[model samples]
Target: MKELYLLLLCMVTTSLGKNKSVDLELDYETASRLAGLPLHCAHVEYPNKLSQVLENQTELLAPSELHPIFYGCFDWHSSVHGHWLLAKVANLFPDTELHQNVRTLFAQQFTEDKVATELAYFNRKWGKSFERTYGWAWLLKLQEELELFKDEKFQEYAQILKPLADYIADLYIDFLPRLSYPVRVGEHTNTAFGLVFALDYARLDGNEKLIEVIRNVSLTFYTPDYDCPLRYEPSGYDFLSPCLQEAEVMSKILDDDLEYSVWLQKFLPQLFAENFVLEPGKVADRTDGKLVHLDGLNFSRAWALYTITKKLDDKDMVERLNAIGDEHIRTSIDNVVGSDYAGSHWLASFLFHALETRNS
Candidate 1:
């Protein structure tokens, strides 16, 4: 009877794994349709037939494009989108070798030299490095990569892997002590990304010492009154503009503090009405409002809110967000279709967390 039960359990486990893999593939395909990117032309074969092709043929398409440090669109956009797609796909296919490809992308992007080249200026002036919002998002992929595969086979190359994440996390930790005032803040996305990375690292390493640091940083921007500054941080990092969406997303994910989420919900309609502009042609970032500076911060938030509401089983919130995202996508198909800003690829990451999250 014991042997029979063991065999049945093994079969059940195998079947469930297979089911998850299939669901992930379907989700990827659906996400591609929702994103409407042109992957077939790029010739970047996707993991599943339904998945959108995500490749930047910029080097092939334009070899003369010299990378002017952080200014090159190809290097900046491709690196971010590529990693986003890879990480989400890996989350979907966790037990399979598909995750290996995700690791490869991270290894290529987060190398010691790349980190130095990208963040050297910030390191010198701030006495620490500044990871762009996109860079912070990339760290999410790397963290997922390490979590999905932490066994002996993966430990061999741990040196190259751990330092990059450790450096970023430690840098943020060091910055905590340096805050001159209790209200020190920066771009919404950067601040949110920093909190998410810090929280995830704290959870992964069982390092509870950093929880206060996370709490303090979060409190600097916590908006229960809605009269606070709603723009992005650093004052000058306004390529896409900052908004409340990224901070909300990070707050939802990192702290699970319902009070913060409630605070966010209270200010949602006013900010959206004032700052968000959804036309049938252009992308939806931030526009007019009290927070006039964050134009590119909406899509990331829209997608994130969509995911979180569903996870929280708040159908009303999901309905509201889906309407918002659908409206934006309808209006700004051109800007969102082929981009990571749409948050299509990170579906797998959210799903992974939904599957893996514990009440603790």
Candidate 2:
């Protein structure tokens, strides 16, 4: 199968050069469709509809050659998309056997290599008990548990997670000097998610100690000035903006602050006012003069803002998010390839979250 794909890819490349109409607008959807070409080799010619690509790819994954991990890819990006799809499938088709099968498979990942890989990271750094700085990516993976296993199922897995949550709380306060630096602030999304998850875990595990941990971390991100910070950027990857927003949301929910909630309500539309434009059914990257993605933060501002704004129930905000989501599907469905898949996956996951929030 690998050889066949390589040969077909070679042929496609050769053919591509000869064609003058190979409109070079390569995005996630285009590449994802190209990758699917070999299987349904005759479904359509070179230029195909982007949205149809995944449908075709799904067909290719059927029966004896059923890649159990059909949605499997090891990176952070893959996990997000696969998890999003599993949740969507479960919610959309709760009674279907196939959906249940996929849900079970997704759930098993909690105890599988993917979980093991993350747990190993936690283990190596924090002694399997979350005593150290867990990266932002860990929180995203933690989210998979909520989708795959909630309530008692989550509690059943609590033994492995509970001590880690405690360790995380201790690590935060004990290493306050490190977490307090501005230059090291707001660099990842997983921080808030991690803290929120920790708090939830604490609540589940009946550990009141976690409440303080959650409060400090939550307030740290919501702190007005970066110079006096609570969240620290580890100085590597850039997933920070959303983390701050997530922290803010966590604060409001945990504290039940109507004022903070109002602040969020006001902040959403203001941020999206001039800087954002969702046109042609795709979320456009900010055209603002200020560096929106300073040093490879990329176009994260748009998505981060979109994620936070959707949480507010403002009628205008919801309408804007809906438009952005449609654009995301249109843009994302047409741009699925390799590392670029992350953007598509991000959109897919966001769409699922947005949809679920609406339905909820």
Candidate 3:
């Protein structure tokens, strides 16, 4: 039976070809299962160690105690995007059991009091840089999802979450001017990855101030960048591709497709090559929390590539990027489930983002 199951898995894998359908049914199933995993796991056994300046011994609190709305899924950022995955899936598949589960969970967690506590945590003196731009970006992404959700319940939830989102936006506007250099890492602190999602949210909500700041900061930090060294990517423990992510954001901020195409050509010239290829980052150990980040690197890279392809006029280049993006999704989507807390805790959100962004 195990051998047969493996064979069936192989067949399913084989079916996900360049021209094959994305299998939204299977995607929805995986999203439902993975999103449900961290929704109620308040006693997260392995939370991310945070930077804290405790005034007293009594001030130190457990993850659940400190972050009432987002205290699960191993870390605050993971928990933030976990809720994002649930919200996205629920909005897309409203009649499914997954949607119902999301509704039930939101009822308990999205209360005004809970959000107020969350806001207070951010406003704390020592917690100014608690999650910084990474967590802040996911919060805005979640708000964007909630704002887009047409359900009255989700709209109410969005309204309730507005104060915290506004706080994070204020942080971005204040922080970017002071940041003389952008962090070019492949991890959570990557400035490009943060700005991309935040920019999206700002545009959707018509926040001119946030939008202008993002555009100016993005151009200031990235406009002169050229020939990003893609071959040196997938730094150990990396979850975001620095080069591709920057390119992705530039594609959005540039004025016109002509400008974007020119910028992309200068930024990642290898994409124009007929034989250019990007293999997905391999993970040697899923049980190791940091090592598994390579899998996320693949998903996020795929998202960037897919988004970049949309802005280009070259049909051949677009098809090539699409194929590569599809391959990256295939590499990691199947592993989003399973019992490994290290990877399972947050990978589904990356997988969901990759597939949903590509297909959308």
lDDT of 2 by residue, 1-360 (tens): 344334434544332211334433333322322433222221112222211123244344221122222223323323434444444444455455434444454455444443444443434422433322333223433443443454454434433343433444555445533455323334432455445445554455555655565566566655443222212331234434443445344543444455544545443333335444533222234232122122123223334444454455566755665555344333333322211322332333433332343334
Candidate with better TM-score, 1 vs 3: 3
Among all candidates shown, the one with the greatest TM-score: 3
Q: Tens digit of lDDT per residue, candidate 1, span 1-360?
A: 223223322333222222232322234333333212222111232221211122344323221122122222223333334444444455555564445544443454445454554443334443243344346545544554555654543433334445555666666566666764433333433455446555655666665656567666566554433533443332432322134334444454444556555665564544334244432113233222213222223334344444445434455554665556444322322222233422322222232232222110
Candidate structures ordered by lDDT, highest first = 3, 1, 2
Against the correct fold, how does model 2 do in TM-score? 0.49
Give per-model CA RMSD.
12.5, 12.9, 4.4
The lDDT, on a scale of 0 to 1, for candidate 3 is 0.82
Better of 1 and 3 by lDDT: 3
RMSD (Cα, Å) of model 3? 4.4
> For model 3, which pairs clash?
none
TM-score of each: 0.53, 0.49, 0.91
Ranking by TM-score: 3, 1, 2
